[model samples]
Target: MENFTEVLSKINTAKVIAPQIDYSDYVALDLSIDNEELAQSNLQNAKEYELYIQRFLDRNKAKIAFGGYLETRNLYQRSTVFKNLNSEERNIHIGLDLWINQTASIHAALDGTIHSFQNNTALGDYGPTIILAHHLEGFTFYSLYGHLSVDSITNKNVGDVIKQGQQIGNLGLPPINGDYAPHLHFQIILNIESNFGDYPGVCNAGKLDFYSNNCPNPNILLKIDNNT
Candidate 1:
């Protein structure tokens, strides 16, 4: 029997973002805690993030910036959901984030049925999110699309049959999209447990082992070169 990672490697998936943009146009973005540039610069708000992302894209000559699977970031410090006096700070991002200044079309990564959808309206939450259940090679897994536009989940229903590459929604703007710049937070989960439309996008250092195993790097399915 193969493990979840091995099983994921067997399938060829479609682009979760619009197909019009080629993978060659993608550039790796580092929001990790170690990024010196990000550390020196102050990126506290959505507008600031948008500006920072745009400058990076302009310099790299890329259409979209993607990365951040299992990367530790300091951007979540402003939200109480990520840290407080009581709970462990969850700064380690567990999903692949695709960033773009404009609102881009979001697509399904594979053929699957909608497991759940909800508008998580917390200060730094996934404003509108969708989760899909996929089955392959005797394994069942899930993909989450977060920071989506409100209309994305407006008419969507549970168990909605979604085809690979189908347009599910568009990237959302700030305040509505958890107060972040326009971006798609994509993650893969082996066991969703009792999670409905939302899942932990970040984890504390102590729980890193378990979360990493449950949520593998989304790049395994995206296959985009992690080149900056």
Candidate 2:
């Protein structure tokens, strides 16, 4: 059997969000801690994030702003879910985020069965999330879709069949989407262990090594090429 990373690299996937939009229309957006622009701007709430993304899209002349796998960010400061005095601040993002203001459709990246679904109601959590288990080339792995609208998990069940490019849900609005701008937090897990609908999408530097291996860059599956 091939290694998980090799298997993922060999697989191809459809656009996991808003399939109608062309890949060429996808522009990269930087919300990382190193981004001077994000540091300079005061993005207070979900509504502000919406406006910020809109401006970014308009300025870039692109339909969507995407990126942020393994990128460190300061945006999580507002929520205790990411930080507390006792815990190492989880500031690094482990999943790729596809951003757009509208409630765009979310799709399955590959053929799989629903592994789990949940509405993590914490202030800065995944909100509505879904995990899919897939087998390819004799390797079993999982895919997670987060920041989805409430309706997404409304009637989902474990082990339900999901097809490649199938519409699974819609991008959630702010507050419902962990109070951030609308986006789909997509991740690939080589070993899900006992994690259900939720997994650590963000981690601190100390835990980066393990997470970097367990959760490979989603682009390996997205085939987005150098995190375009």
Candidate 3:
């Protein structure tokens, strides 16, 4: 069996995040819905996460920001079982959420063509999303960016090549951004069988193992934290 790590290691390091954005403009939000306080936590507490993102924007208005790792969540994974719990309940989060108050210019982390894009209009859905495909390190992978402004895909077509750090879209606001807060849902995918526009940002308890491996830590390629 081909190990996923082997594929990741083969990714073209030179092409990934070449025009890296400053971390000062972005903050980490919930990555998993593992904790009760945050998992079942209401949107009111979104400020905590939003604020973190805002601070990054406040410092670097012109630069892009990034964060939201496994440690970004209250729970260990993103599971519906957790979401079914009460506010004090612990849940898991699956995606890395990048925070920025207004619609910050979203860029492609690498050179890739648009695989799919859609407006996932749902209370907790991605609202607006885009997925790109790229071949790196002898392996092909996909990157999903969620909670984007509806206009982002106004005239974009599938297979369109987006260069690394190229402005692809901007962030959307609440009510349109899944009602959580203003932020972007960024995820690195290995084999995306189908789930277009939106994937399981949160997984069920039974499939934890599957998701953990299928969706390797995005920071591995993003290298968001150079200081650490």
Candidate 4:
């Protein structure tokens, strides 16, 4: 059996957002615990966090801020959803986040069918989410789009076919999008197991190996060279 990375290389390079945005407009953002600016700021609320993101984009003269795959972030401390009673907190992000304006059109990375979707209503959750099942070279996998507006999943049914670059939905606002800054959390899952519309986008330190293997870096398909 081919490993996930090997199979991912065979898929076409994709752009999850609009094509008008130049690759030069994409800047790498760091929300990890080591980021001094994030540590000093008051980011407990979505609005404040949104402003922080705005400042970063403005300073860098970029339209989109990306990164966060497998990064350990301090932002998750605000939500208990990532914590276990006696276990290590899940601070490792497993998805690639693209920070952009609310209502920005989201695109499908490849041809797939709607596997599942739901509105996760928790304070810090996915809000409106969608999962698409895809196949390439006889191997099957799944793609997850989180932090989406309700309209994205509305009127859509399971098994709906989604073509590459198809408009899947729009980026959601705070409270509606798990109360965080507007962004799309895109993840690739090798085995969804029993997860439906939602899957663990963050993982505990000890389980990093497992999740990292199951969920490869989305950049493999996005092919985003943030340094540009």
Model 2, residue 121: distance off in Å is 0.7
Better of 2 and 4 by TM-score: 2
lDDT of each: 0.92, 0.90, 0.65, 0.89
lDDT of 3: 0.65
Q: Weakest 10 consecutive residues, lDDT, candidate 2?
A: 219-228
lDDT score of residue 48 within candidate 4? 88
Kindly report which residue stretches of model 3 are placed more than 4 angstroms away from their true locations once superposed: 1-21, 24-68, 71-90
* lDDT of each residue in 53-128, candidate 1, tens digit only: 9999999999999999989999999999899999999999999999988869999999999999999999899999
Better-scoring candidate (lDDT), 2 or 4: 2
The best-first sequence of candidates by lDDT reads 1, 2, 4, 3
Runs in model 2 deviating more than 4 A are 226-228
lDDT against true structure, model 2: 0.90
By lDDT, the better pick of 3 and 4 is: 4
Off by over 4 Å in 4: 84-87
lDDT of 3 by residue, 66-120 (tens): 5544443542223233355553333334557665565467778788999999988
Q: Mind giving the per-residue lDDT tens digits that candidate 4 earns over 139-203?
A: 78999999999999999999999998899898889899999999999999999999889999999
Superposition-based RMSD of candidate 2 using all C-alpha atoms, in angstroms: 1.4
